[model samples]
Target chain A: MDSKLTTTHPMVTADSQSVSSQEEIVLSVQHVKKKIGKKWIIKDVTFEVKAGEIFGFLGPNGAGKTTTIRMLVNLIRPTEGTINICGYDVTKQPEKALAYVGSIVENPEMYPYLTGWENLEHFARMQPGVDEKRIQEVTEIVRLDERIHDKVSKYSLGMRQRLGIAQALLGRPKLLILDEPTNGLDPKGIRDMRIFIRELASQGMAVFVSSHLLSEIQLLCDRVAIVGRGSVIAVGGVTELVEDTQHLVIWELEPQAQGEQILQSIPSIQVLDLESSNLDNDTAASLRPHSIITATPEEYISTTIATLVQAGIQIHNVRKLSPTLEQLFLGVTEGEFIE
Target chain B: MNSIWPLVQNETIKIIKKKRFYVVLLVLLVLVPMFTYAQMRQAQENRTKFGEDWRVELQQAITDNQNSLGSDRVPEEWKKYRRVFVQQMQYYLENDVNPNEPGGVTFTREFLDNSSSLFIPLLIMTIASDLVSAERTGGTIKMLLTRPIRRWKVLLSKLITLTMFVSLIVVSTFIISYVISGAAFGYSGFNIPVFTGFQPGDTGTDMSSVHAIAQWQFILMQMGLIWFVGLTVGLLAFMVSVLVRSTAASIVIMMAALIAGTILTNMAASWSTAKYLFMVNLGLTNYLSGSPAPIEGMTLPFSLGVLAVWALASVIVSFAVFTKRDVLN
Candidate 1:
């Protein structure tokens, strides 16, 4: 607990700075606050997403992540602040602003009664510069060309997701806002979406994605803003923010009583309490009872396992566990502060 | 994107794909045949009774109505309607032209006149109520409003599509009634001289302005007035669709209002203020056929003004609310 606090607290209080300031800023949300009814849902949020980057909007559910994304795409009006996209104000000049933006707020809801191709045509008509060729190109980009002629109701969930991305790319927007893009995807589908998002970013399009899962953002995003209780708690490079909480070693042993006692004698390592951990029960269930999770520096993991084994403990496995964004950014997602 | 035509095209395709207009066509297909069968049966009965003398038939109708006007049991409003019928039949008798000419064109004209108040406007509501609410229910509104076009432009395109379908519905009603009724009643009355331009008032109708025109011209004018009523009702339903979130609810609200209008039109004549309701003023065809208006102080100009005001208010409400309301989940 002492090491976790010392590692993540200073970064949480640090000013949110863009990691890659050299690229063109495609989206700038400045002090955005949204008030629904009498209570303020989003107290204050500010972030800039540059061109050629996957900027992850990281937050827990009800942390106002979706509400903030809505304000960005002009789906919901922000009571107090400005959202500009590619040099255009989203609220004042949504026509010019949204011209450079393509978004799927939740699920991509195309006209189910219309064929996939007809759905493309329906949206293509609303976007300037999107013609038959452009629609065909986007359909190919999402790899939905084979089923483009079928009714969307016949589409599988992954295919519907691909079609959603296909329509978003129809306008050739500079910035794409996807709210929980991988919320309902299979594992392979999620992998393909990450690759697809990276390919778009490499082509100089800015991708702003929001997700409640920190691990998803940790693997996918170049930079992230961690939101908690309707405000941004921290924004920095994903690597820089995750740098402090180094090695997470999973100590598996027989004779767990002797092994745990021997590991507690080491000064450099600290064991994480499974019951006290903020991770939901599913994550906890995956780790067996004989396995003990510990956070320690890289140099001590081998020695800690050696000491456990020398104490006549049978070493079944010495596996290294990577710290989740949940544990790495404890100042933001800590159990006491999250809700 | 600069032009609203693409949006209109999109809406047109949705309406077609959803088969909403097909529903309207099917309703007409089933109803018009039954109407023709009923008319054919009525015509057969009349022929057997009158022995081919429309003059004798007209004189007998006038005597019956005149006798009813003198009866104490006859309501004052019923007596007023009889008085107008008696006057109109007397005019036809003096002119030596049968008002009940049995032909395709005559049947279409008569059908349009009767359908204008309730039938045609109800058909208009089917498409108009589905205009905006379907998007909300189906969750496509999020995509629709996020486009580069202003919100009002999106709504305007829908309004244009609704208008096109409303006009299509009215024109199809005319054609279907004509074609089907023509197959049942022979199609040779287009050149018959028909009298129009009757100025109906509180006490009686003024026939000084009445003049003879071809049966086709009278049908054309009646269609023009009915189209106006259909368009007005379409605008109101469009407003309901904007205000209500579900298409079924929007349709129900409009159906209730239209049914209420029908009931109100049958009500006592003393409810003079009810004329302002757009539903009650939907009978614009009555002025053309020289029938009495439902209430006192109601005339062609008065009904037109009332309908115009209602349509204007609905348009204002639809645009104002649709452009401003939050598209909440």
Candidate 2:
């Protein structure tokens, strides 16, 4: 927990220093618009991932996440915009721009006839001076050694995904772009990928991960840009966006026979819910004082608890519950929803 | 350059390892012998049907025809056989020549010239038609394009590999046809004379004198001309492969063009410019064979220039289209 405190401090100083140094803008897309026939896939969308950040491109299905990632990797040209990566404009100098980026789009279109190692070797050879040692490192990093020599046609969906990641990691790319890297992964595999991504970020490799998995974004991404229907709706640190509203105060407590009556009697404070489902009577007796209240910070939440005790409700526990990312995501995106 | 080499290697591997490529080679293997055997059989039948010694038969026919003609002699149709017969008798009397000179390189070369309407052209088409279009079907096109290399370089490498294989196939055909036919007809005549430089107006009689060009030199010249046609068709098929998304479509399109060209050359004698089409000029050894030009006055240079134009056009169109076209879904 304390590690989070230290990472934030260093990131702040490094961001400021990088801003002055002009080294932070590893990728910049300014007003990128892509229209396929009559429909726009990515409209005036823009963001940048610095040299060493796990920047999550968070969105729902059909939210232009894949389109944005594709444009960044120069797989598709935008109808109107300039995308610059590693000091080269992607359109003007695509080969050079692409040289700095390693990407995995929709599904990894690997050669099915080739073995997993052969697939990596082929892509590895695509990037010059990328030695066999690097190949081994990437294969090990993605934990594909046991099956690296097996033909890709024999690979399961999850194994193929890992192999795709191994290929992306082969060149030690300055910018690694992954589209839903965990889309088909099991729980353990997702955990491993999250750790691996964090390790890459720790090693100063910036990653652009586009996914609808908001919890993973919150857990893994240092920063995220949220998009919907070809436009970015929100962008910032997860905590900053989620904790912007301080009114929600969640607390837990012990059972009191008159717990509901006591909290309801308090003015301008509403006690939201109580559950006896996961509790014994003794446990319920200890947690029957549970409540959630919405109020200004200046309006003490303790006042509701004090009132409850005075009204003959036994109180054993009370503490604020941190807002889950799901609630925060709902709040941020739902605000954009039309009635 | 390093980035593209891997792509090139993979492309080369894909082409060389494909069963279709080897299948084409195997078909050529079975076919060359079949055609050579069939040609030898037909020549044997002609020998038996006419006479054991074709020269004696030719002299007898010419003497009888002359006696029959008595007053009005040497009609146009008789002129051809008479001239050939007279030459055969003169050759027999002067050098003790025999018309049946035991089939050899000379016989096979002649056999190839007649059989080329279908054999060599089909062999060339089999390899070239599906080179790129097959990649599209295998879903390897997407894998190839997404590599960090430029699109043109990818297509360029494929073209290079195709060119190399085309050369290999052409050279292989010449050697195999020679070796197989040579075994039955022993390779003693390394320096046999063949005719060349037969321009249309050089001889008014249309039956020009056979000046001596060596058998190997003649084969080399014919190979050069066939290679030109093969390269043109290969490049054209490449263009078709680029334009058409399916292997079957590409092969059918090229095959139709080839067949149509042969048919038109046979049937369209009145259409002088038909000689200028790429297909008509594919029979490069026509001058040696002394067949009338498919078009009345079309010369070698004119037909070559036309084929060159089509070849160049296909090259330009393929590169331009392939480099820019959006990939398959």
Candidate 3:
């Protein structure tokens, strides 16, 4: 889906036009640093989230993702540097800077005793110009209208997440920040949240989602920044980050022992043994002993296949492996353990 | 700043919805009636033991105090107390008024005046002690502080809401006490005369300061005075709530201080400095009722000044800590 496409909904479109102008930056962090006691929690972090985009913040555990987010939301002050939201400095004028921002820091915790509608209404009262109609609209947008009257304690985790989003969406915020928005969601709930967040971005709201779930972030975010050890290691479009690098090409051939020896003779080809048995018995028997081979230039796949076939080994299948976000993350972080 | 009103309104709603307030109301609901019933039974026994003539009873009480004054075994403090009692008893006897009347308004006024020192403070602390800390535990403080409002404004709104609720609880206590006790003891005595300003001086009762006021007027003044003390207690608890992260700790600390204050007021006469403690001055109603100050040389103005300083310091510290501290979960 093209998340950049403008929706036909009048309210959303009007909001999009008024608040988001294509490339306008909604959130900017410049050389932000945070120190707690003697240790640096966030070290020289800097990034920007543009209008009409889902910007994913990916990091290993204890990598300062939450610390950066807290500074952006003004829950804690940065020891150094400035954060501007919609042109207002967060430290100097937090009330004005945060006026256009809505966020769920870690969990969408609310008053468990209060009903979902009451929670929305309570937060709505915190911001100006958020009336009953806007509350209803956001509630419907989250598909929580049917259960909005129930107490938050009774709502499932997925429902609580939706209600939290509804609360943030009140006042039609220009920037919606969700720290681990889908932390405790089921597969269907995660999918629903991904689509809903994209829909929010399409309506012109900039979303900053921080998560350890690389696959979800890969599918949901238009742009992503990976942070490791208190610093951002990579930032760009997901497709560009994954596709801009060299990858392996696996060539499956018949009579694997003969095919391996044939490919071994070629100086350009590198054959890696299968580390573990991943193939099912039926595919293994039907395919009749195929081995894996890699071409260094990747474009040499045709030559490697031709060379193998000429040596009397029948080529059964040829597959090119594209890098996934997980692979890219592991590669960039040097296989660092992610929590 | 323009959103302070809505913020205050929201806070008020949040407080009222908590089950703690209902628990407070329930305690009051059961407590006042039981107290009034005991008072009624005591009054009945008094009538049965000493005939129905309040004048005769007043004369006998004065004679007994006069007799005690002649005894050398009485402590100097009791001698001073007996001297004031004799003078006040004579005044009541001359005026043909019964000071201890078994009626709704009379019991309420007396109950509030007596309990202001401890019970009322305890109830107000229940609501105030959790004002900020409960939000932290429930994780709602993040939601509240992250809004497009200043932290001071948010804390100020909570303070204002606490002031409002303290007033509400005080008024409700009176109303609930009156209604429940009135059912048992007839709702009369609104116009009954109650005397004030019988100060205990170095020698005897300070007759020059004595005066008389109706029971309703006395109750109103008592309510106003107790409300001030309650607000002071609430403010102190508010500061503790901000400083401490747990609701139970805040309430316990405040309660411990108050309970210690009551004990100190009786025994800390020698300490002298104990009179300056904030909790010591919480009995503001004592001044209106013309009761002797708990400590020597501690007058109404002195107590008020001490309480004012405490309240001011609490406000400043609470705001300073809350606005600057990092809200880590």
Best by TM-score: 1
Cα lDDT tens digits, model 2, B55-145, are 6655665576556545465554444434444444444445454433555677657656764555666776776777778766665565455
Ten contiguous residues with the weakest lDDT in model 1 chain B: B196-205
Q: Candidate 1's residue-wise lDDT over A247-335, tens digit each?
A: 56777788887788777778887777875445455556778877887767878877776777677889988876666656655644454
The residue pairs in collision within model 2 are: A253-A287, A254-A286, A254-A287, A254-A288, A254-A289, A255-A285, A255-A287, A255-A288
Give me the runs in candidate 2 sitting further than 4 Å from their true place: A1-23, A146-150, A184-188, A239-339, B2-8, B43-47, B50-104, B107-131, B134-143, B146-148, B187-189, B197-210, B271-277
Q: What TM-score does candidate 1 reach?
A: 0.91
lDDT tens readout by residue for model 1, B75-161: 888888888889988999998999998999999989998899999999998889988999989889988988888999999999999
Candidate 2 at residue B305, lDDT?
87
Q: After aligning candidate 3 to the native by TM-score, how far in Å is the CA of A198 from where it should be?
A: 1.5
Docking class of 3: medium
Q: Compare candidates 1 and 3 on lDDT and give the better one.
A: 1
Candidate 1: interface RMSD in Å? 1.0
Best of the candidates, DockQ: 1
Q: Where does model 3 exceed 4 Å of error?
A: A1-20, A244-330, A333-339, B59-87
DockQ-based class of model 1? medium
lDDT of 3: 0.82
Q: Residue B197 in model 2: shift from native, Å? A: 4.2
